[model samples]
Target: MIALLLALGSSLAYGCADFLGGLGARKAHVLRTVMVAAPASLAIELLLWPVLGASFDPGAIGWGAASGVASAVAFALLYKTLALGPMNVLSPVTALVSAALPVGVGLIQGERLGTAGLLGLPLALIAVVLVSAGHGAGSSRPSRTALLLAFGAGAAIALQLVFLHQAPADSGVAPLIVGRAVSTAVTLTAAGVLRRRLGREKPAYAMSAAAGVLDSVANLLFLIAVRSGDLTVVAVITALYPVGTVLLARSVLAERIHRGQLVGLGTAAVAVSLLALTST
Candidate 1:
Protein backbone atom coordinates (compact mmCIF):
# COMPACT_ATOMS: atom_id res chain seq x y z
CA MET A 1 0.00 0.00 0.00
CA ILE A 2 2.80 2.40 0.84
CA ALA A 3 4.66 1.51 -2.31
CA LEU A 4 1.50 1.93 -4.35
CA LEU A 5 1.00 5.43 -3.00
CA LEU A 6 4.61 6.34 -3.69
CA ALA A 7 4.39 4.97 -7.21
CA LEU A 8 1.22 6.95 -7.83
CA GLY A 9 2.94 10.08 -6.54
CA SER A 10 5.82 9.41 -8.86
CA SER A 11 3.46 9.02 -11.79
CA LEU A 12 1.76 12.34 -11.05
CA ALA A 13 5.08 14.12 -10.72
CA TYR A 14 6.35 12.64 -13.96
CA GLY A 15 3.18 13.69 -15.73
CA CYS A 16 3.50 17.24 -14.44
CA ALA A 17 7.14 17.38 -15.40
CA ASP A 18 6.44 16.23 -18.94
CA PHE A 19 3.63 18.76 -19.28
CA LEU A 20 5.90 21.61 -18.26
CA GLY A 21 8.77 20.32 -20.35
CA GLY A 22 6.51 20.23 -23.37
CA LEU A 23 5.57 23.84 -22.75
CA GLY A 24 9.21 24.86 -22.40
CA ALA A 25 10.19 23.01 -25.54
CA ARG A 26 7.58 24.90 -27.53
CA LYS A 27 9.33 28.19 -26.78
CA ALA A 28 12.86 27.08 -27.73
CA HIS A 29 14.88 24.22 -29.11
CA VAL A 30 14.42 20.89 -27.30
CA LEU A 31 18.13 20.86 -26.46
CA ARG A 32 17.92 24.34 -25.05
CA THR A 33 14.97 23.38 -22.90
CA VAL A 34 16.82 20.29 -21.63
CA MET A 35 19.89 22.42 -20.93
CA VAL A 36 17.92 24.20 -18.26
CA ALA A 37 15.93 21.16 -17.08
CA ALA A 38 18.97 18.91 -16.64
CA PRO A 39 20.95 21.40 -14.52
CA ALA A 40 17.89 22.10 -12.42
CA SER A 41 17.39 18.36 -11.88
CA LEU A 42 21.05 17.99 -10.84
CA ALA A 43 20.73 20.87 -8.41
CA ILE A 44 17.66 19.32 -6.76
CA GLU A 45 19.36 15.93 -6.50
CA LEU A 46 22.39 17.53 -4.92
CA LEU A 47 20.15 19.18 -2.37
CA LEU A 48 18.42 15.85 -1.74
CA TRP A 49 21.71 14.06 -1.14
CA PRO A 50 22.33 15.84 2.18
CA VAL A 51 18.82 15.15 3.45
CA LEU A 52 18.43 11.58 2.15
CA GLY A 53 22.08 10.65 2.65
CA ALA A 54 24.21 9.15 -0.10
CA SER A 55 26.93 6.59 -0.70
CA PHE A 56 28.87 6.46 -3.96
CA ASP A 57 29.32 2.71 -4.04
CA PRO A 58 30.49 1.09 -7.28
CA GLY A 59 26.99 -0.20 -7.91
CA ALA A 60 25.59 3.26 -7.43
CA ILE A 61 28.00 4.94 -9.81
CA GLY A 62 27.89 2.24 -12.49
CA TRP A 63 24.15 1.68 -12.62
CA GLY A 64 23.44 5.40 -12.22
CA ALA A 65 25.77 6.22 -15.10
CA ALA A 66 24.16 3.53 -17.22
CA SER A 67 20.71 4.96 -16.48
CA GLY A 68 21.99 8.43 -17.35
CA VAL A 69 23.21 7.28 -20.75
CA ALA A 70 19.91 5.58 -21.40
CA SER A 71 18.09 8.73 -20.32
CA ALA A 72 20.04 10.83 -22.80
CA VAL A 73 19.32 8.39 -25.59
CA ALA A 74 15.64 8.26 -24.73
CA PHE A 75 15.38 12.04 -24.55
CA ALA A 76 16.99 12.56 -27.95
CA LEU A 77 15.24 9.78 -29.78
CA LEU A 78 11.79 10.54 -28.31
CA TYR A 79 11.85 14.18 -29.35
CA LYS A 80 13.17 13.31 -32.78
CA THR A 81 10.48 10.71 -33.27
CA LEU A 82 7.77 13.18 -32.25
CA ALA A 83 9.18 15.74 -34.62
CA LEU A 84 8.98 13.29 -37.48
CA GLY A 85 5.14 13.38 -37.20
CA PRO A 86 2.33 10.95 -36.33
CA MET A 87 2.74 11.52 -32.61
CA ASN A 88 -0.63 9.89 -31.96
CA VAL A 89 0.68 6.49 -32.99
CA LEU A 90 4.33 6.91 -32.07
CA SER A 91 3.76 8.30 -28.57
CA PRO A 92 1.56 5.39 -27.49
CA VAL A 93 3.93 2.91 -29.08
CA THR A 94 6.83 4.37 -27.13
CA ALA A 95 4.91 4.34 -23.86
CA LEU A 96 3.72 0.76 -24.39
CA VAL A 97 7.16 -0.52 -25.25
CA SER A 98 8.73 1.30 -22.33
CA ALA A 99 6.27 -0.20 -19.86
CA ALA A 100 6.36 -3.67 -21.43
CA LEU A 101 10.15 -4.02 -21.30
CA PRO A 102 10.45 -3.33 -17.59
CA VAL A 103 7.53 -5.65 -16.86
CA GLY A 104 9.25 -8.36 -18.87
CA VAL A 105 12.53 -7.78 -17.02
CA GLY A 106 10.83 -8.00 -13.65
CA LEU A 107 9.12 -11.28 -14.59
CA ILE A 108 12.33 -12.78 -15.96
CA GLN A 109 14.04 -11.89 -12.66
CA GLY A 110 11.49 -14.18 -10.90
CA GLU A 111 8.96 -11.69 -9.66
CA ARG A 112 5.60 -13.40 -9.13
CA LEU A 113 2.15 -11.84 -9.09
CA GLY A 114 -1.22 -12.89 -7.69
CA THR A 115 -4.37 -13.17 -9.80
CA ALA A 116 -5.34 -9.55 -9.22
CA GLY A 117 -1.92 -8.32 -10.16
CA LEU A 118 -1.87 -10.51 -13.22
CA LEU A 119 -5.11 -8.95 -14.38
CA GLY A 120 -4.13 -5.41 -13.40
CA LEU A 121 -0.79 -5.48 -15.17
CA PRO A 122 -2.23 -5.98 -18.63
CA LEU A 123 -4.93 -3.41 -17.96
CA ALA A 124 -2.26 -0.97 -16.82
CA LEU A 125 -0.27 -1.56 -20.00
CA ILE A 126 -3.34 -1.02 -22.11
CA ALA A 127 -4.18 2.09 -20.11
CA VAL A 128 -0.71 3.45 -20.82
CA VAL A 129 -1.29 3.12 -24.54
CA LEU A 130 -4.76 4.61 -24.49
CA VAL A 131 -3.91 7.52 -22.20
CA SER A 132 -0.91 8.44 -24.32
CA ALA A 133 -3.02 8.49 -27.46
CA GLY A 134 -3.59 11.94 -28.91
CA HIS A 135 -6.25 13.41 -31.20
CA GLY A 136 -4.41 13.70 -34.47
CA ALA A 137 -2.21 11.24 -36.29
CA GLY A 138 -0.61 14.11 -38.20
CA SER A 139 -0.98 14.51 -41.95
CA SER A 140 1.46 11.79 -42.92
CA ARG A 141 2.21 8.37 -41.55
CA PRO A 142 5.43 7.88 -39.58
CA SER A 143 8.40 6.86 -41.66
CA ARG A 144 10.64 3.84 -41.05
CA THR A 145 13.15 6.08 -39.33
CA ALA A 146 10.48 7.40 -36.98
CA LEU A 147 9.32 3.89 -36.08
CA LEU A 148 12.88 2.78 -35.32
CA LEU A 149 13.54 5.86 -33.25
CA ALA A 150 10.33 5.35 -31.30
CA PHE A 151 11.26 1.78 -30.46
CA GLY A 152 14.80 2.77 -29.53
CA ALA A 153 13.54 5.57 -27.30
CA GLY A 154 11.16 3.22 -25.49
CA ALA A 155 13.91 0.65 -24.91
CA ALA A 156 16.18 3.35 -23.59
CA ILE A 157 13.50 4.54 -21.18
CA ALA A 158 12.98 0.98 -19.92
CA LEU A 159 16.72 0.54 -19.44
CA GLN A 160 16.89 3.70 -17.37
CA LEU A 161 14.32 2.43 -14.89
CA VAL A 162 15.88 -1.04 -14.74
CA PHE A 163 19.35 0.38 -14.14
CA LEU A 164 18.05 2.63 -11.41
CA HIS A 165 16.48 -0.39 -9.74
CA GLN A 166 19.80 -2.23 -9.99
CA ALA A 167 21.61 0.42 -7.94
CA PRO A 168 22.63 -0.44 -4.39
CA ALA A 169 19.78 0.18 -1.98
CA ASP A 170 22.17 1.60 0.64
CA SER A 171 23.27 4.27 -1.83
CA GLY A 172 20.23 6.45 -1.03
CA VAL A 173 19.87 9.27 -3.53
CA ALA A 174 23.45 9.01 -4.76
CA PRO A 175 22.40 7.14 -7.89
CA LEU A 176 19.98 9.89 -8.79
CA ILE A 177 22.65 12.51 -8.18
CA VAL A 178 25.07 10.68 -10.41
CA GLY A 179 22.49 10.07 -13.11
CA ARG A 180 21.34 13.68 -13.13
CA ALA A 181 24.90 14.95 -13.25
CA VAL A 182 25.71 12.76 -16.23
CA SER A 183 22.53 13.78 -18.03
CA THR A 184 23.30 17.43 -17.31
CA ALA A 185 26.71 17.01 -18.89
CA VAL A 186 25.17 15.37 -21.94
CA THR A 187 22.65 18.18 -22.27
CA LEU A 188 25.39 20.78 -22.10
CA THR A 189 27.48 18.96 -24.67
CA ALA A 190 24.57 18.61 -27.04
CA ALA A 191 23.68 22.26 -26.59
CA GLY A 192 27.23 23.25 -27.40
CA VAL A 193 27.27 21.19 -30.57
CA LEU A 194 23.96 22.62 -31.72
CA ARG A 195 24.36 26.17 -30.39
CA ARG A 196 23.99 27.71 -33.81
CA ARG A 197 20.73 25.91 -34.36
CA LEU A 198 19.30 26.79 -30.95
CA GLY A 199 17.90 30.11 -32.22
CA ARG A 200 17.75 33.50 -30.53
CA GLU A 201 14.40 33.35 -28.80
CA LYS A 202 14.41 33.62 -25.02
CA PRO A 203 14.06 30.18 -23.46
CA ALA A 204 11.32 29.39 -20.96
CA TYR A 205 13.70 29.18 -18.04
CA ALA A 206 11.00 29.10 -15.35
CA MET A 207 8.99 26.32 -16.94
CA SER A 208 12.08 24.30 -17.73
CA ALA A 209 13.41 24.63 -14.18
CA ALA A 210 10.09 23.61 -12.69
CA ALA A 211 10.06 20.57 -14.94
CA GLY A 212 13.53 19.60 -13.74
CA VAL A 213 12.55 19.90 -10.10
CA LEU A 214 9.42 17.84 -10.60
CA ASP A 215 11.34 15.26 -12.62
CA SER A 216 13.87 14.87 -9.80
CA VAL A 217 11.06 14.37 -7.30
CA ALA A 218 9.47 11.78 -9.56
CA ASN A 219 12.73 9.87 -9.87
CA LEU A 220 13.22 9.90 -6.12
CA LEU A 221 9.74 8.53 -5.54
CA PHE A 222 10.15 5.90 -8.24
CA LEU A 223 13.48 4.76 -6.81
CA ILE A 224 11.98 4.46 -3.35
CA ALA A 225 8.85 2.73 -4.60
CA VAL A 226 10.80 0.20 -6.68
CA ARG A 227 13.02 -0.63 -3.72
CA SER A 228 10.00 -1.45 -1.58
CA GLY A 229 7.62 -2.93 -4.12
CA ASP A 230 7.55 -5.39 -6.97
CA LEU A 231 9.17 -3.84 -10.02
CA THR A 232 6.37 -5.15 -12.22
CA VAL A 233 3.73 -3.33 -10.20
CA VAL A 234 5.75 -0.17 -9.62
CA ALA A 235 6.84 0.12 -13.24
CA VAL A 236 3.32 -0.28 -14.55
CA ILE A 237 1.99 2.32 -12.14
CA THR A 238 4.72 4.77 -13.03
CA ALA A 239 4.08 4.28 -16.72
CA LEU A 240 0.56 5.61 -16.20
CA TYR A 241 2.09 9.09 -16.09
CA PRO A 242 0.52 9.94 -19.41
CA VAL A 243 -2.82 10.10 -17.63
CA GLY A 244 -1.64 13.08 -15.63
CA THR A 245 -0.31 14.79 -18.74
CA VAL A 246 -3.54 14.33 -20.62
CA LEU A 247 -5.62 15.62 -17.73
CA LEU A 248 -3.34 18.62 -17.27
CA ALA A 249 -3.58 19.45 -20.95
CA ARG A 250 -7.30 19.45 -20.73
CA SER A 251 -7.42 21.75 -17.73
CA VAL A 252 -4.48 24.06 -18.39
CA LEU A 253 -4.27 24.18 -22.15
CA ALA A 254 -8.04 23.71 -22.53
CA GLU A 255 -7.26 20.90 -24.96
CA ARG A 256 -10.10 18.55 -25.66
CA ILE A 257 -9.85 15.10 -24.10
CA HIS A 258 -10.79 12.41 -26.52
CA ARG A 259 -13.02 9.39 -25.77
CA GLY A 260 -10.15 6.93 -25.89
CA GLN A 261 -8.23 8.86 -23.25
CA LEU A 262 -11.31 9.07 -21.05
CA VAL A 263 -11.68 5.32 -21.19
CA GLY A 264 -7.98 5.02 -20.42
CA LEU A 265 -8.32 7.16 -17.32
CA GLY A 266 -11.11 4.92 -16.04
CA THR A 267 -9.20 1.77 -16.89
CA ALA A 268 -6.11 3.05 -15.04
CA ALA A 269 -8.13 3.73 -11.92
CA VAL A 270 -9.52 0.20 -11.92
CA ALA A 271 -6.08 -1.25 -12.52
CA VAL A 272 -4.58 0.68 -9.61
CA SER A 273 -7.44 -0.34 -7.33
CA LEU A 274 -6.90 -4.00 -8.11
CA LEU A 275 -3.19 -3.75 -7.51
CA ALA A 276 -3.69 -1.94 -4.24
CA LEU A 277 -6.21 -4.53 -3.03
CA THR A 278 -3.82 -7.38 -3.80
CA SER A 279 -0.91 -5.58 -2.16
CA THR A 280 -2.92 -5.11 0.98
Candidate 2:
Protein backbone atom coordinates (compact mmCIF):
# COMPACT_ATOMS: atom_id res chain seq x y z
CA MET A 1 0.00 0.00 0.00
CA ILE A 2 2.74 2.44 0.87
CA ALA A 3 4.55 1.50 -2.30
CA LEU A 4 1.44 2.15 -4.34
CA LEU A 5 1.16 5.57 -2.74
CA LEU A 6 4.78 6.27 -3.56
CA ALA A 7 4.21 5.20 -7.15
CA LEU A 8 1.12 7.42 -7.35
CA GLY A 9 3.09 10.33 -5.99
CA SER A 10 5.80 9.65 -8.54
CA SER A 11 3.24 9.74 -11.33
CA LEU A 12 1.96 13.15 -10.26
CA ALA A 13 5.45 14.56 -9.90
CA TYR A 14 6.48 13.13 -13.27
CA GLY A 15 3.38 14.59 -14.91
CA CYS A 16 4.17 18.04 -13.62
CA ALA A 17 7.79 17.61 -14.65
CA ASP A 18 6.81 16.59 -18.16
CA PHE A 19 4.44 19.53 -18.46
CA LEU A 20 7.15 21.96 -17.48
CA GLY A 21 9.73 20.26 -19.66
CA GLY A 22 7.45 20.52 -22.66
CA LEU A 23 6.71 24.15 -21.93
CA GLY A 24 10.39 24.92 -21.56
CA ALA A 25 11.16 22.98 -24.69
CA ARG A 26 8.88 25.36 -26.57
CA LYS A 27 11.40 28.10 -25.80
CA ALA A 28 14.46 25.98 -26.67
CA HIS A 29 15.45 22.64 -28.07
CA VAL A 30 14.44 19.74 -25.87
CA LEU A 31 17.97 18.36 -25.78
CA ARG A 32 19.30 21.68 -24.66
CA THR A 33 16.62 21.93 -22.04
CA VAL A 34 17.57 18.48 -20.80
CA MET A 35 21.25 19.34 -20.54
CA VAL A 36 20.50 22.33 -18.34
CA ALA A 37 17.77 20.51 -16.45
CA ALA A 38 19.81 17.39 -15.72
CA PRO A 39 22.53 19.37 -13.98
CA ALA A 40 19.89 21.26 -12.06
CA SER A 41 18.30 18.00 -11.04
CA LEU A 42 21.66 16.57 -10.07
CA ALA A 43 22.29 19.57 -7.87
CA ILE A 44 19.06 18.87 -6.06
CA GLU A 45 20.08 15.27 -5.50
CA LEU A 46 23.44 16.35 -4.15
CA LEU A 47 21.72 18.68 -1.71
CA LEU A 48 19.63 15.81 -0.40
CA TRP A 49 22.53 13.41 0.02
CA PRO A 50 23.40 14.25 3.65
CA VAL A 51 19.78 13.91 4.70
CA LEU A 52 18.86 10.79 2.66
CA GLY A 53 22.14 8.92 3.11
CA ALA A 54 23.33 6.28 0.64
CA SER A 55 25.74 3.34 0.49
CA PHE A 56 27.81 2.72 -2.60
CA ASP A 57 28.29 -0.59 -4.42
CA PRO A 58 29.73 -1.56 -7.78
CA GLY A 59 26.64 -3.39 -8.96
CA ALA A 60 24.30 -0.57 -7.99
CA ILE A 61 26.49 1.97 -9.75
CA GLY A 62 26.71 -0.17 -12.87
CA TRP A 63 22.96 -0.76 -13.17
CA GLY A 64 22.21 2.85 -12.29
CA ALA A 65 24.57 4.10 -14.98
CA ALA A 66 22.98 1.81 -17.52
CA SER A 67 19.55 3.05 -16.56
CA GLY A 68 20.72 6.60 -17.04
CA VAL A 69 22.00 5.87 -20.54
CA ALA A 70 18.70 4.24 -21.38
CA SER A 71 16.78 7.23 -20.00
CA ALA A 72 18.95 9.57 -22.08
CA VAL A 73 17.99 7.73 -25.22
CA ALA A 74 14.36 7.62 -24.18
CA PHE A 75 14.03 11.36 -23.55
CA ALA A 76 15.94 12.36 -26.67
CA LEU A 77 13.86 10.14 -28.90
CA LEU A 78 10.64 11.09 -27.13
CA TYR A 79 11.21 14.81 -27.48
CA LYS A 80 12.18 14.36 -31.14
CA THR A 81 9.00 12.39 -31.71
CA LEU A 82 6.97 15.12 -30.06
CA ALA A 83 8.54 17.67 -32.36
CA LEU A 84 7.64 15.56 -35.38
CA GLY A 85 3.94 15.01 -34.89
CA PRO A 86 0.80 15.02 -32.76
CA MET A 87 1.47 14.24 -29.11
CA ASN A 88 -2.09 13.01 -28.84
CA VAL A 89 -1.26 9.92 -30.84
CA LEU A 90 2.40 9.57 -29.93
CA SER A 91 2.26 10.13 -26.18
CA PRO A 92 -0.26 7.39 -25.51
CA VAL A 93 1.53 4.96 -27.74
CA THR A 94 4.79 5.62 -25.93
CA ALA A 95 3.21 5.37 -22.50
CA LEU A 96 1.46 2.09 -23.30
CA VAL A 97 4.53 0.49 -24.76
CA SER A 98 6.78 1.70 -21.96
CA ALA A 99 4.44 0.20 -19.40
CA ALA A 100 3.63 -3.03 -21.21
CA LEU A 101 7.27 -4.02 -21.55
CA PRO A 102 7.82 -3.83 -17.81
CA VAL A 103 4.63 -5.73 -17.18
CA GLY A 104 5.78 -8.44 -19.55
CA VAL A 105 9.11 -8.60 -17.77
CA GLY A 106 7.39 -8.98 -14.43
CA LEU A 107 5.28 -11.83 -15.74
CA ILE A 108 8.31 -13.56 -17.16
CA GLN A 109 9.83 -13.38 -13.71
CA GLY A 110 6.74 -15.27 -12.42
CA GLU A 111 5.14 -12.38 -10.64
CA ARG A 112 1.46 -13.18 -10.12
CA LEU A 113 -1.49 -11.16 -8.98
CA GLY A 114 -5.19 -11.51 -8.23
CA THR A 115 -7.94 -11.05 -10.76
CA ALA A 116 -8.78 -7.56 -9.58
CA GLY A 117 -5.20 -6.42 -10.10
CA LEU A 118 -5.16 -8.08 -13.49
CA LEU A 119 -8.31 -6.25 -14.52
CA GLY A 120 -6.91 -2.88 -13.45
CA LEU A 121 -4.01 -3.14 -15.91
CA PRO A 122 -6.18 -2.85 -19.02
CA LEU A 123 -8.26 -0.06 -17.48
CA ALA A 124 -5.07 1.87 -16.66
CA LEU A 125 -3.87 1.42 -20.25
CA ILE A 126 -7.17 2.78 -21.59
CA ALA A 127 -6.77 5.70 -19.25
CA VAL A 128 -3.31 6.38 -20.69
CA VAL A 129 -4.68 6.49 -24.25
CA LEU A 130 -7.56 8.79 -23.40
CA VAL A 131 -5.59 11.10 -21.13
CA SER A 132 -2.84 11.57 -23.70
CA ALA A 133 -5.37 12.46 -26.40
CA GLY A 134 -4.96 16.11 -27.33
CA HIS A 135 -5.88 18.61 -30.02
CA GLY A 136 -2.93 19.58 -32.19
CA ALA A 137 -2.29 20.34 -35.83
CA GLY A 138 -1.79 17.18 -37.91
CA SER A 139 -2.64 15.17 -34.82
CA SER A 140 -4.96 13.00 -36.86
CA ARG A 141 -2.18 11.99 -39.21
CA PRO A 142 0.87 10.54 -37.47
CA SER A 143 4.07 9.95 -39.43
CA ARG A 144 5.70 6.52 -39.57
CA THR A 145 9.01 7.85 -38.33
CA ALA A 146 7.32 9.43 -35.34
CA LEU A 147 5.60 6.17 -34.53
CA LEU A 148 8.86 4.23 -34.69
CA LEU A 149 10.69 6.76 -32.57
CA ALA A 150 7.90 6.76 -30.03
CA PHE A 151 8.06 2.98 -29.79
CA GLY A 152 11.82 3.08 -29.37
CA ALA A 153 11.53 5.73 -26.71
CA GLY A 154 8.97 3.66 -24.87
CA ALA A 155 11.23 0.65 -24.87
CA ALA A 156 14.10 2.70 -23.57
CA ILE A 157 11.97 4.15 -20.80
CA ALA A 158 10.95 0.64 -19.77
CA LEU A 159 14.55 -0.50 -19.83
CA GLN A 160 15.58 2.36 -17.59
CA LEU A 161 12.83 1.69 -15.08
CA VAL A 162 13.44 -2.04 -15.05
CA PHE A 163 17.20 -1.70 -14.69
CA LEU A 164 16.90 0.87 -11.93
CA HIS A 165 15.26 -1.84 -9.87
CA GLN A 166 18.18 -4.13 -10.48
CA ALA A 167 20.39 -1.95 -8.32
CA PRO A 168 21.14 -3.61 -5.02
CA ALA A 169 18.56 -2.70 -2.38
CA ASP A 170 20.99 -1.71 0.35
CA SER A 171 22.79 0.65 -2.04
CA GLY A 172 20.20 3.32 -1.25
CA VAL A 173 20.29 6.55 -3.31
CA ALA A 174 23.75 5.89 -4.70
CA PRO A 175 22.07 4.36 -7.70
CA LEU A 176 20.11 7.56 -8.25
CA ILE A 177 23.27 9.62 -7.96
CA VAL A 178 25.06 7.50 -10.49
CA GLY A 179 22.07 7.54 -12.80
CA ARG A 180 21.86 11.33 -12.73
CA ALA A 181 25.57 11.68 -13.29
CA VAL A 182 25.39 9.38 -16.27
CA SER A 183 22.43 11.30 -17.68
CA THR A 184 24.25 14.60 -17.35
CA ALA A 185 27.33 13.20 -19.07
CA VAL A 186 25.29 11.66 -21.88
CA THR A 187 23.24 14.81 -22.42
CA LEU A 188 26.42 16.92 -22.55
CA THR A 189 27.90 14.56 -25.13
CA ALA A 190 24.73 14.66 -27.16
CA ALA A 191 24.75 18.44 -27.06
CA GLY A 192 28.35 18.61 -28.24
CA VAL A 193 27.80 16.10 -31.02
CA LEU A 194 24.76 17.99 -32.31
CA ARG A 195 26.36 21.42 -31.84
CA ARG A 196 23.44 22.45 -29.67
CA ARG A 197 24.12 25.80 -28.06
CA LEU A 198 22.78 25.46 -24.58
CA GLY A 199 21.77 28.59 -22.61
CA ARG A 200 22.24 30.76 -25.70
CA GLU A 201 18.50 31.19 -25.92
CA LYS A 202 16.72 33.00 -23.12
CA PRO A 203 16.49 30.43 -20.37
CA ALA A 204 13.10 29.53 -19.07
CA TYR A 205 14.75 29.07 -15.70
CA ALA A 206 11.74 28.89 -13.44
CA MET A 207 9.84 26.27 -15.42
CA SER A 208 12.94 24.31 -16.37
CA ALA A 209 14.31 24.26 -12.83
CA ALA A 210 10.95 23.30 -11.45
CA ALA A 211 10.85 20.45 -13.93
CA GLY A 212 14.28 19.32 -12.80
CA VAL A 213 13.34 19.33 -9.14
CA LEU A 214 10.10 17.47 -9.70
CA ASP A 215 11.67 14.85 -11.96
CA SER A 216 14.43 14.10 -9.49
CA VAL A 217 11.92 13.67 -6.70
CA ALA A 218 9.81 11.44 -8.92
CA ASN A 219 12.75 9.18 -9.69
CA LEU A 220 13.51 8.80 -5.98
CA LEU A 221 9.94 7.90 -5.26
CA PHE A 222 9.90 5.37 -8.08
CA LEU A 223 12.97 3.70 -6.63
CA ILE A 224 11.29 3.41 -3.26
CA ALA A 225 8.05 2.16 -4.82
CA VAL A 226 9.59 -0.56 -6.93
CA ARG A 227 11.46 -1.89 -3.90
CA SER A 228 8.25 -2.37 -1.95
CA GLY A 229 5.66 -3.20 -4.62
CA ASP A 230 5.20 -5.47 -7.59
CA LEU A 231 7.18 -4.09 -10.54
CA THR A 232 4.32 -4.52 -13.01
CA VAL A 233 1.76 -2.87 -10.75
CA VAL A 234 4.05 0.01 -9.86
CA ALA A 235 4.93 0.65 -13.49
CA VAL A 236 1.32 0.56 -14.65
CA ILE A 237 0.12 2.81 -11.86
CA THR A 238 2.90 5.30 -12.46
CA ALA A 239 1.99 5.31 -16.12
CA LEU A 240 -1.20 7.10 -15.02
CA TYR A 241 0.92 10.23 -15.34
CA PRO A 242 -0.96 11.28 -18.46
CA VAL A 243 -4.00 11.93 -16.29
CA GLY A 244 -2.07 14.65 -14.49
CA THR A 245 -0.80 15.97 -17.80
CA VAL A 246 -4.36 16.20 -19.13
CA LEU A 247 -5.59 17.99 -16.03
CA LEU A 248 -2.72 20.43 -16.23
CA ALA A 249 -3.40 21.05 -19.90
CA ARG A 250 -7.02 21.80 -19.19
CA SER A 251 -6.13 24.27 -16.45
CA VAL A 252 -2.84 25.87 -17.46
CA LEU A 253 -2.87 25.63 -21.25
CA ALA A 254 -6.60 26.29 -21.52
CA GLU A 255 -6.92 23.16 -23.59
CA ARG A 256 -10.43 21.92 -24.09
CA ILE A 257 -11.33 18.90 -22.02
CA HIS A 258 -12.36 16.11 -24.28
CA ARG A 259 -15.14 13.74 -23.17
CA GLY A 260 -12.80 10.83 -23.58
CA GLN A 261 -10.32 12.48 -21.26
CA LEU A 262 -12.97 12.95 -18.61
CA VAL A 263 -13.86 9.31 -18.90
CA GLY A 264 -10.22 8.44 -18.73
CA LEU A 265 -9.82 10.45 -15.54
CA GLY A 266 -12.66 8.54 -13.93
CA THR A 267 -11.42 5.20 -15.17
CA ALA A 268 -7.96 6.02 -13.89
CA ALA A 269 -9.40 6.67 -10.48
CA VAL A 270 -11.14 3.30 -10.54
CA ALA A 271 -8.03 1.58 -11.76
CA VAL A 272 -5.91 3.12 -9.04
CA SER A 273 -8.39 2.11 -6.43
CA LEU A 274 -8.50 -1.46 -7.62
CA LEU A 275 -4.76 -1.69 -7.96
CA ALA A 276 -4.13 -0.24 -4.55
CA LEU A 277 -6.70 -2.50 -2.94
CA THR A 278 -5.05 -5.58 -4.37
CA SER A 279 -1.33 -4.75 -4.29
CA THR A 280 0.81 -6.59 -1.76
Predicted structure with the largest TM-score when compared to the true one: 1
Each model's Cα RMSD: 1.1, 1.8
lDDT of 2 at 127: 88
Error of 1 at 184 (Å): 0.7
lDDT of 2 at 146: 91
How would you encode candidate 2's per-residue C-alpha lDDT over 94-199 as one tens digit per residue? 9999889998998898888788888888898888777877655343878899999999999999999999888888777888889999989999888898875554
Report lDDT (Cα) of residue 53, candidate 2: 76
Cα lDDT, all candidates: 0.92, 0.86
lDDT of candidate model 2 versus the reference: 0.86
What's the TM-score of every candidate structure? 0.98, 0.94
- Tens digits of per-residue lDDT, candidate 1, 125-202, equal 999998998866555588899999999999999999999999999999999999988888888998898899999877
Off by over 4 Å in 1: 136-140
